[model samples]
Target: MENSAGCSVSLWQKIVSFLLVIFPILDIYSVGIKGIGIGSIILCFILIGMGIRFLTLNRSIKLNPYYGFFLYGLCISLLTVLIHNDFSITAVAIRMTYFLFYTLLIFLPSSYDFDIHFAEQIYLKIGMAAGAFLILQYFSFWGLRYNLIGLIPGLPLNYAIEDYVEWMDAYNNMYTIMFRPTSFFPEPAAFTQYMAPLLILVLFTNVGEKKKLLKAAFISIVMILSTSTNGIVFSLFIWILYFVYINHDSLKNRRFPIFLVPLFLFAIVFAILILFTDNTISDYTVQQFEGLFSKNQSSSAYLRIMRGFDIYRQLNFFENILGIGLGTYKSYYATGVLTVYDGETEYMNSLSYLFVSTGVIGVLLFIYSLFYNVPRRSMASHALAFLILLSFFSSSLFNSPTYALSYLFLLHLDSIKNSGD
Candidate 1:
């Protein structure tokens, strides 16, 4: 009976690990019946079961200091809601649910006794699977002129082709036809954001050099095929950092400039593509790169990077400090209660959303919580945290459980390393 029980527990652990591996995809709106994601529903049930199990076993719930930070932020959000007298039950409930999801994710690893190495392997494999699917997706479009995503049946009411397809005109005629592979995500950019930290782990952490390069190459291809400005720029930034800082020690030990070889090969391949191919994708990429710096009000670059700050500037002094309230930004923006820039349609940046909704104090507490446990000696930990922080400026993923889980996993890995050290 004891052996059987142990086997059952192990099986459940594997199930949880698998669920986490695909959690981002599972969290998509199309994967759920309503506004709630399938991932959330499953996790909520797991949380309840775990809660009951803990009670039956008389287990003490171990709390991290970050929990206090989250609690404080929740209090601040409630206060903001009260201050504004915008007590919409649905809105407050949604915000509360998000908080609960974050807390549950934070509790997960410890409760399940998740092995960091095992989790890394699972994440790597799943990432590879996503990459393989993306490649197949790309070819299907290239050859058949049909998006394989359309073949997947019975998506929820919220699912739409426009959510996954990148319109050609959006790139200002850089390409006649373009299909971005999302690989189970609502958009390609979300897929890239989900994969970014995994890329960092593969490149910077203590993985075998050959394995690292292979995995990095595959992941980089997926990011490129996605054609997301943020993904491409992030990939370039991390690769440069890897070559400069991470590879410096190895370069000093080796006589040959082996590291520079990859860059040279990449340049040659790029030149060949520009010279021989239609160069539509390359031209579109360059246009987007330029748009990143364009002063045009209608540019996606401006809206994603600077428009949030522009919106924040318009807020009153008190609103700037304490925020308007939790979950109020969407309604305010939709109703034109909040002043927006000429081309702004919605909040794309998470930092801006946090600033406008939770105010300065909430933002500080949240940031502090993520970094509080990071060991100063662990460069990998710092790099992981920095990448996550940078991603906030690109999208409104502040409430995403996948991002929360990534941070939690980082802390778990850091704790194990610190213990070994």
Candidate 2:
């Protein structure tokens, strides 16, 4: 009877924990910034409670990579507040929230029994739901509208309607893309920033089960849709290259030089096929590449990259050790656009954006916090590192925080792997 009660309690804990993690906190939080996000507050409390419960049971969980991450992030938040003097307080708060939740996420999944594989199940469900919400927003609704507009072919809708209202209210007409929906985030790219890392996680799901594969694929497709070419293309590139690099043994299928040569050649050709086909799915990426080399691409992404660089350059040298203060990107809290560079089309990628936001020192600290898990090498390590690489290329500048979700997930995955070892 005592054992039965214990089993019942453990199952209930797993169920609650799963709900807590995948409960669409981002969607609820999306309604308002952190200050007003009721959903965020609720989940925050639940996660805190759970962590406290664990602490009570286990006094000596010992130091893991998460401790280092906590210290590094705390330092970043402090520096941002001290140097920027603008909204650095907000940065401090932001980093604190992320650190708290991230630390909980690292240990929370392990609090349950291993029988159900419930954590992976929650991830898949979250991806599926996020995908569905995005599809409803983009294709079924926005897709139909965009196509109707495209039929006319000469509509003056360069910017998203919201961006237009934004510029026009201030009495300017800067064009922006009216991107598809991101359930919790403001834009598709932001959604991609979170979901792309899940793609790496997906590779670790139960591959032996067809049901799991279908579920995983469904989530992957939805995430793929949530992404713009920037996130999708870059994530795909990094995943393929990194997966190939790390899984060289898995690819070999046999163990001989002659076989290895054929396998490598096959991989190269297979990769080319995936890239060429995938790149066309979104004209956004194609235009960026084309603009850089050929004359047929969108110049906005390139321009955004340049602007991010400008911000980094404009900051005083002292801002390197400390940030210009967290959230110091704007002054007087006006409807200000940070356009240090003038360009026809400016869409910033990930790495350049974060580098400016956090500066060189911040970036280094951030990278260290992200990948402190595996001192040894494995496919999983390679995959996580590559996802970080992908994050830099896709949405780092405007939406650097997207990587936070992925970072926590990756950290947990690493802990699980090493715990077994």
Q: What TM-score would each prediction reach against the true structure?
A: 0.83, 0.63
Model 2: per-residue Cα lDDT over 142-161, one tens digit each:
33543111111222222233
Off by over 4 Å in 1: 1-9, 29-33, 53-65, 111-113, 157-176, 244-248, 258-262, 265-277, 330-337, 342-345, 375-377, 415-421
Each prediction's number of clashing residue pairs: 0, 14
lDDT of all predictions: 0.65, 0.48
Candidate 2: segments with Cα more than 4 A from true spot = 1-25, 28-36, 64-116, 129-186, 210-227, 238-247, 254-285, 288-300, 331-339, 342-350, 375-378, 396-402, 414-421
Q: List RMSD in Å for every model shown.
A: 4.7, 8.2
Local error of candidate 1 at 252, Å? Answer: 1.6
Give the candidate number with the greatest TM-score: 1
Sequence-dependent TM-score of model 2: 0.63
CA lDDT of 189 in candidate 1?
80
